[model samples]
Target: MAEQNRTSVAELVLEGLSERAEVKAALFVLLLLIYTLTLLGNMGIIVVIWGDPQLHTSMYFFLGSLSMVDICFSSVTAPRTLVNFLLERKTISFTGCMGQAFFYTVFVTTGCFLLAVMAYDWYVAICNPLLYSSVMTHRLCIWLVVGSYIGGVLNSIIQVTFIIRLPFRSSNVINHFFCDVPLLLALSCASTYINSMILFSMAGVIELSTISTILISYIFICFAMLRIRSSEGRQKAFSTCVSHLTAVTMLRRTTIFIYLRPSSSYSPNTDKVVSIFYTLVIPMLNPLIYSLRNQEVKSALRRTAERITVRL
Candidate 1:
């Protein structure tokens, strides 16, 4: 009977970001612009890194990977959101919702690991300059990225397995713009105590672990920067890490706020807003922040532009 109940609901309705038609239209336009910029900005970074041999270092390699992940991460939710704004029904099949949750979790978890890896890259470059090239060899970087994806996939499989086992018979209306763990758990008729425990434990293992690595790496980086005799060298060393630090802070704060807590305290309104910032705003901001702030990226862009002009 419980199994029958779970299988009965073929589709679920999404109570999206807003109820008002005007607000929906406005949000649709705003998010469309943000999504467009996110694609262009991240794609531009990838292009610049690929075209400029000078930018083909470990740092830029990681940055390129980060941009690619950002693009995938944002797309996981944004297109559905835009479509939801235009549709009156705002409905998704049960399988569709689960797939959405699964992919979002994978991309987000992968991103966390990627950020931590980037921090380690900075630590090696600053503290162990002599070993940076060997430590962050192309093969190692590739494996690190592949390992991050594997970790994310494993995490997603665990979470989604638990989710699919629960009977979602209470209600099918999710109170956010898209499918998320907390929102989906709320729709389950079965007790989600174990599910919540798993989420908390995963958060501890994934978020806390990655955050600790980043913090420790930065500590070493700061110590190394302090050892630099020249003020200009210190400033330059610090500048390279600023953008990554900013991105890490932005991602960590909102993610911890949303996922690390007990579901009993889940506030849909606040969570939805924070989700917008991380899912929509951050992707658009990351590329612009890195490109505008990094000297190497700016120089590469200038060179790429000059080449295009000469070609014409």
Candidate 2:
């Protein structure tokens, strides 16, 4: 009976961001612009890093990997969202909904690990300059990236497996623009205590672990900076960290707010607003934050642009 109930719903309806005609029109244009910029900005970062020999270092390699992940992360939701704005009845098949949730979890989890690894990279580079080269070798960087993706896959499989087992026999309507685990869990007819516990516990663990890594790395980075006598030297060291700190704070806060609590406490309106920020806004901002703040990235962009112009 439970299995039959689960398979009964062939399609789920998405109650997207807005319903009004004017609002949908405005959102379509605004979201289209943001999505375009996200692709262009992230893709630019990857291309610049790949083409420039000067950026052939551990730091830029991680930045490139991050850019690629951001592209995937935003792509998982943004395109569907744009399409839904045009359609009167915004709907997704059961399989498509689950697929979105799966990939969304994978990229988001991978992104968190990447940020944590990047924090550690900064720690090594700033705290142990002499050993940075030896410590963060190309082989080690590649393994770190591969491990992040693997961890994401494992986590996603577990979470989605739990969701798949539940019989969503009540409402086929999801409150947000995209399919999220918490929202999906809310739609199930069966008692979601186990599912909620798993979601909260896993989210808590991931958040606690990753945030701790970032905090500890920054603490060490702070001490290392203070050890430098000159104010100019200290400032230079601190500047490199600003971009990463901004990105981490934004991503962590939004994710924790959404996932670390019981689904009963969820406010549909508030969740939609926050989801838009992290899903659409943050990916758009990351490359801009990194490139605008980093002089090395700026120089590399200029070099890449000049080479392109020459070819043209």
Candidate 3:
């Protein structure tokens, strides 16, 4: 621990991406391009979904929620990184740091659970097409999304509780972009055993349970596909899972990388680099993945554009 814990944290220094100015400048330009692309891509998803009414199905509903979350998730961290690139003073208040940590956790966790629900949705849709309409009713969809939000809030509360209990007498500098649990815990001056335990337990529950459920659902889907006699049927069924799988794999893999580590081994620098995936890249990739791959979305976009062009 540092000798003196000051009453006022005059400045929250960034022990930035190394001491070399050249490296920082390079990171700046690269991240700025990614940040801009993230915003535009996610915004495009929301716009395209909103403009098209046929996309009001449960799947698209989930897709819209995902876009909204990705937007919020990216906003929570990217702006700070962009600002750090340009600003002379690279500091965030203690309260602000906590705020970013809270929201980031909320959105990311919610997105994770929601993605699991999406996998299950695909399962129900393909495995039981006859019953899909009944099983995935408006009420059921609402409940599933609500459940995701509830679960995320509880998860965030547990993580945030761990963060609040830790003593920060050692260092005020939070390396990387935002306040994340693993990194923040590393800086704490207290015994973070309890917090680390809770974090691990939560990760096991959220990540393991969700991933297991999705995997099982896909297993059943695959089995059902195998039984189908027609080649077209198998291809069509597998296509349904592809986009969801892409999104889930992108998020779950990276989250496991970041959260599954011990506090002692947590690296703020590495966290920042990978954090860009979930925070910026995945969100942008999702809409594009779903939209471009699906004929319906592309056709809808074309028709919508045609209508506008005709009116003009």
Per-prediction CA RMSD (Å): 1.2, 1.2, 2.9
Q: With candidate 1 superimposed using the best TM-score fit, by how many Å does residue 234's alpha carbon deviate from the native?
A: 1.0
Model 3 residue 90 CA deviation in Å: 1.1
Candidate 1 ranges beyond 4 A from true positions: 1-5
**C-alpha lDDT values of all predictions:** 0.90, 0.92, 0.79
lDDT accuracy of residue 257 in candidate 1: 88
lDDT score, residue 180, model 1? 81
| Model 2 CA lDDT for position 277 | 95
Report the lDDT tens digits of candidate 2 across residue range 58-88: 9999999999999999999999999999898
Backbone clash numbers for all candidates listed = 0, 0, 0
- Model 3 spans > 4 angstroms off: 1-11, 18-22
Per-residue lDDT of model 1, residues 182-285, tens digit only: 77888888888999899889978998789899999999998899899999878778887888889999999999888887556778889888999999899899
Q: lDDT of candidate 1 vs native?
A: 0.90
Candidate 3 lDDT at 173 equals: 79
Best by lDDT: 2
Judged by lDDT relative to the true structure, which candidate is superior, 1 or 3?
1
Q: Indicate the residue-level lDDT of 102 in model 3.
A: 86
Candidate 3 to native Cα RMSD, angstroms: 2.9
